[model samples]
Target: MRRRLLDIIHRFYLDAISRLPPAEFRRTTGLARGLHVGGHCFGPLHPVHNIVVNSIWYAAAFPVRRPAGSDDEDEANALLSTDGIARICHRSLDGLVAALRDLCPSLSNGDALWRLFSTSADLTAAVALANGVSKSINYLSKVLVPSSPHEPSVSPLMLSAQVLDCIASQKQQFKGIGNQVVNVVNMALQQYTQRSGEQLKLHSVCGASLLMEEGLENCYHINFLAYHEGSGSAVGAPVLFFTEAIILSCYETDIRLCVPVDPVTDIGCCFACESNRKMVVHPCYDEYLGGLEFQEDEVDYGSDFPSPLDVDYIFFDADRDSAFANYLWRDSTDH
Candidate 1:
């Protein structure tokens, strides 16, 4: 009866996973695909549900091998002899099974079995599990309660919504980090000008410029680079096209001075320099206005500074132009 109940619970979880929207299903299945037992891919026909379930079962059944020797035993000689190693290995397997039996007592209890299946399928329960609260029956009971009384006991849609909320929270934190970096850079530039008696302007490139043709603004960090242009035609006159002025602010901030290594293969690296840190300033001295050329600093104080480590870099694929683009396409099509 217990075995039958577990099977039914597993089937219900599988049905919930299958019922997820195509995009959510793809996202969840992509996570599941990371569970390659021996670096083998499950072909297209293999159901993602089966892969995830079997992986969980395999992990639960085969816990880590514990050392069989006592505290005083020679750790270095533990695996010296084949027969001795085999004996220790067998003992470790036996110990793991016993440990699991003790940890999960009374599988015959339907409540215990239900708790196991429900927690496995619940994202919130996973978070609780990380904090060592999932094992508490009272906590699980409270957590597993449906938001709406009429809603199903557990659903993939709910889990997906939780995942999205977590993602949004993380994105906001990343944006904060980028903003902090920009503020720090600008303050440092001001300090440099005060000490050196030379004014340096801050020109910020839009985050969208760093993105691909239709990339999303999901970067988390900004970059910085500097260039000074000198005149070749006249002495002490601002150069038309010379490139060897050492911008002190650039050096003080440790910004990259050289271009990217490979433009095509590592275009992101090139753009990383362009969007966050690249500064091109020409100091023109004239007789009319006390030899001071005032150039308007074009600073993008908006929340659009691109990051060196964008979402595209994280979820890159050779077949797809961008994972974010695919997500947008699927989202629009679904709507």
Candidate 2:
């Protein structure tokens, strides 16, 4: 059943990519590649994990392009409209959730976890709306501020006030949805623990945290850090996959955030001794990690076995790069 679900997910993912506009298709594929590279720095993830998260990220970050004569108000209204790629992705995600519910009938009985999956469509739409508003505000800011001394200068404070005023209603709507999302996430986590007999901790910086830490009211710039008790010794594949999925789902969504630092390279560079020539460390540490004597022995699995529990122990393979590239680039002109 799990393998069948994964196959359906893979097909849905490909269909979503195929339906995207040409430019967005390229951007989505590029984002997926970037995720693969960044994730490989930490550990190998199942290919389906990458596919699922990439689809979500692309949907969330999908922009609302304003018509040539359309005003900011029109664009804002359009953002909330049930149309375009965001809506398409929402349908695909809904189908995916329905399939899951069908496969696991237990989830249909007022399950909080099921509710989370259902509400994610709204969350994705909210994120897209936030992105649209952010872009609109940015555009207003540029237009309000004089580019040359010949024009009258606008006060920075007044500019900010005006921008905030313009998006006040939209901000309120987004805030309401954001609050609901947080509540749903909490309930979902509780439900997850009850069912799996495992407690997952989520350390997130957004909403109130953003206001407290950076005095930024931008709710789109979210960061999630999660772990389980076993994370210290050996992270379970499911935990790692879900963590990556959640983080990637929120990434590049009007946040304009910095790339996360590579932990292994940072640690090695900071702590390595300069006296030992053999101890020299570089950013490319994949070889060193592979050569470590303490590394676990990997069995030679000749076939791709996607487990029912969605935990697949695997290693990164350089040979797969070409195949991935081909897969992403194939049928590019069709859309």
Candidate 3:
């Protein structure tokens, strides 16, 4: 994960930016490189916000998707799920604030929190330009309640609407503090999902059961590379790009929320793996529905989030597990 990500960072990214169209360079100059690099006259009033925002903008192009097995993890758009990236950003945000304090000096305590707000707004714009609907849905998952593991409850659409109502017309706390970031993140995620709820809800449809539990640990590793900072136990397992879609406030007082949804293998009506930490929530399609059914907003499910199931990344001309190895093993390394 780190290798491919670093390659993209050093090669695909830098090469592209340095060779940007002259016109685009002039037009987006203020946006691409703001106060961080110290802009010229008429530059954006705030560069820190824009720089983080732009990273999110680029991230929208990379949506989270089912990880294809040995076939390779590259060429997949999902750099991070909404929750995944947010976690990353939370971490990165802290790192930036820590590194910046000694250097910027003027901004005192609580300043980092404010910067997160400004950066979040920029990310909102980026999400709008790309997968507007999925992003919207992603944001909505936070408030919506999924049904339990074994029940067929309210339709995702209906559940989503209720969740939206809670968010859109709420007197909820923190609603006004980071107003710009909160509203836009909510808007972009809601719209993104509404438009492509079908594809976005793939995991709910798959219904695959967990295959390898503790046995699979350390057997494989993942890497998620992206621009946002993060906090998690990818456990140094090469899970790069975990913050592809995130906004951060702070760790103890504030943290990014994420929902890592995986598509079920087309043959079932379930999801495979779902893992989460003590503080995070690991909701299922059913549990989310149940929450809405009972009007429960602050309910908590114990530490039992299932892990993700590996997909047949190498679906060539057959439909067997061996077929995965046959095709996926054709001259490639898992990115």
Q: Candidate 2: lDDT over CA atoms?
A: 0.34
| Tens-digit per-residue lDDT, 1-335, candidate 2 | 33343344344445444543434334422333222222111001222344445544544565346569865441111121123333433444454445335534555433423343333322222222334442234434444673675866543322233333424544566566556445434544555566677756654423212221122233222223334657454244322111101222333223222122232443322111111112222232322111223212232324443321101102212233334223323423334
Predicted structure with the largest lDDT when compared to the true one: 1
Whole-structure CA lDDT of model 3:
0.30
Tens-place lDDT per residue, model 1, 93-185, is 233234323444543334343443445423233234434664445444654663566854532222234334544555676676556556544
Q: What is the C-alpha lDDT of each candidate?
A: 0.35, 0.34, 0.30
lDDT tens digits, residue span 55-163, model 3: 4354344333545564442332312134433343344444444543443356553553344343442222222223324333443353266546886454322223333
Of 1 and 3, the candidate ranking higher by TM-score: 1
| TM-score against truth, every candidate | 0.20, 0.20, 0.16
Query: Which pairs, if any, clash in model 1?
Result: 223-276, 223-277, 224-277, 225-277, 230-239, 231-239
TM-score of 2: 0.20
lDDT-best of 1 and 2: 1
Evaluate residue 113 in candidate 2 and report its C-alpha lDDT on the 0 to 100 scale.
Answer: 31
